[model samples]
Target: MQLLLVFQGRKLRITVILGAHNVRDREQSQQRIHVRQWVIHPKYSCEGFKNDIVLLKVGINTSPPAHLPKPLNLFLVPSGAECEVAGWGRTSLTGNGSNVMREVELKVQKEKICQQLFKNYQPQSMICVGDDYRKKGVYKGDSGGPLICNQKAHGIASHVPYGYVYPEVFTRISYFKPWIREQLRKFSLQDLPGSPFSD
Candidate 1:
């Protein structure tokens, strides 16, 4: 799978490390991946739940590793579809986060049900997934990981309740497709070499 190289935090520097396994020393394991550009959805808000997607442009032209290819989610994901959520997040509600990445299967919940569970739920931009009664889902430190359905990157882990009691929320990629396309267009106009901007 093609990896999205993101530069965040106060320093804003490029660094990479494999997600599948644990690294003993983060600084020593660093591998730099260039980022052409990135854009956070204009309507996104830290204080609110809507529009929590971000699109990144990586400077890589090589074929993806092995059988992994870039995922495309151009259509709306239907509710009840089984999706995989993977991340280096907490294994349990009160447990310490994992060093190695973990993945779990979850079913997408209906928007109506999600709205009932969360008063501020944004059906147009956000999706809710996981077991409503069972405590199985993405937890702390899982934000920003991919939610894969049918081998397509359909969602981004956005939020979960403080006590990890509620179903995990995700920013629906299909809902923000227009904005994503617009951002790619804007970035491509700059004509940067090896820019990862394509339909």
Candidate 2:
């Protein structure tokens, strides 16, 4: 098993690990596929956290792919739906990240809650999640993680306002389903020789 280290910025490096339980563990079953390329959404806005999804092209591998939850369920996710968010991020305000992957259960908040919290809240593109009273949520290092509801990935952890005390915002996957499909189709056709989509 190999670990592919990809640099996001001059100071930020990311290691995409597959089939691994512990971040520090070098288990024989774990495999790290090298990322060949990545594409960010053209309409992404940093200020408002709109269209904040990225597609990555990785090298082909023999490891069986993990079962991904189907996108676009054709039904709306009701408010207060219990969901889970997992990450290797810090557990506390001043604590360091854990070595093992961890997850926390949070409920989806109503659109009005986010509207009251954020000036730029866009319900069409974002999902608000967390337990405000309990002060439980995705912390500093949990950004870009998935908000899994009923086994489907509904959101991507986007930002937390003023800290984790308030609800965290996520990029709604369902809202951008068309964009995701278009990107995947483009990437799939890129490998053909002399194709216009070729990298």
Candidate 3:
């Protein structure tokens, strides 16, 4: 059977990747769009170490979400790392910039802190951020987007409650790394079950 790759004859129309609904809503979030290609993508997270992988793939919020839990576990780019958070949701309730996108600076916060502030809502491996002053933050349309830092993805935007000054909830990434590798290996035949790391 042939899979339908897109609707309206275009992936661009259906995909959330780099699209308008993903622009963030911060005062300085404007120019940050230039970093689209600058962040690391698995192959390298930093110099010399060469394993500073950081990227994200946003998807639609499916209904009856399978076995997924309410907290909505996500990826953890890493704690205390510097990264950018992007979304296409509104800067205010009115809506984000109509013409431009949005991005904001984020400092990965301690998982414990997140849990405490969120009434123990955070889970293992979760890295939270953006509970700062009442500037714009992620909203309903922004789910499944990236919470990047140090040019790597730390988490995905999982949930944001109403009246949130800024989005504080997120999903961790590192725990999923092994699962991602296993699938890649099976698909590409890149390595045996116990192969060493490679370039």
Candidate 2 residue-wise lDDT at 130? 81
Best model number under lDDT: 2
Point out the higher-scoring one by TM-score: 1 or 2: 2
lDDT of 3 by residue, 1-199 (tens): 1122342477422222232332334343222222111123344322222232333222222223112222333433446566677665556665553335467776655666666656545355445666565365666565666776655555667665456645466656664566455554443442345555211
lDDT by residue for model 1 (1-199), tens: 2444444544454433443356444554455456555677777777756778776566654335222212253335678889898888888788988887788889888787778767778876787888766557898888888888888777889988768645878887777766766776786675756656442
TM, every model = 0.75, 0.84, 0.51
* Candidate closer to the true structure by TM-score (higher is better), 2 or 3: 2
Q: All candidates' lDDT scores?
A: 0.71, 0.77, 0.49
Global lDDT for candidate 1? 0.71
Query: Global CA lDDT of candidate 3, please?
Result: 0.49
At residue 147, give the lDDT of candidate 1: 86
Give the Å error, residue 190, model 2. Answer: 0.8
The best candidate by TM-score is: 2
Candidate 2: where are CA atoms >4 Å away? 1-15, 61-75, 194-199
The weakest ten consecutive residues by lDDT in model 1 span 62-71
In what order do the candidates fall by TM-score, top score first? 2, 1, 3
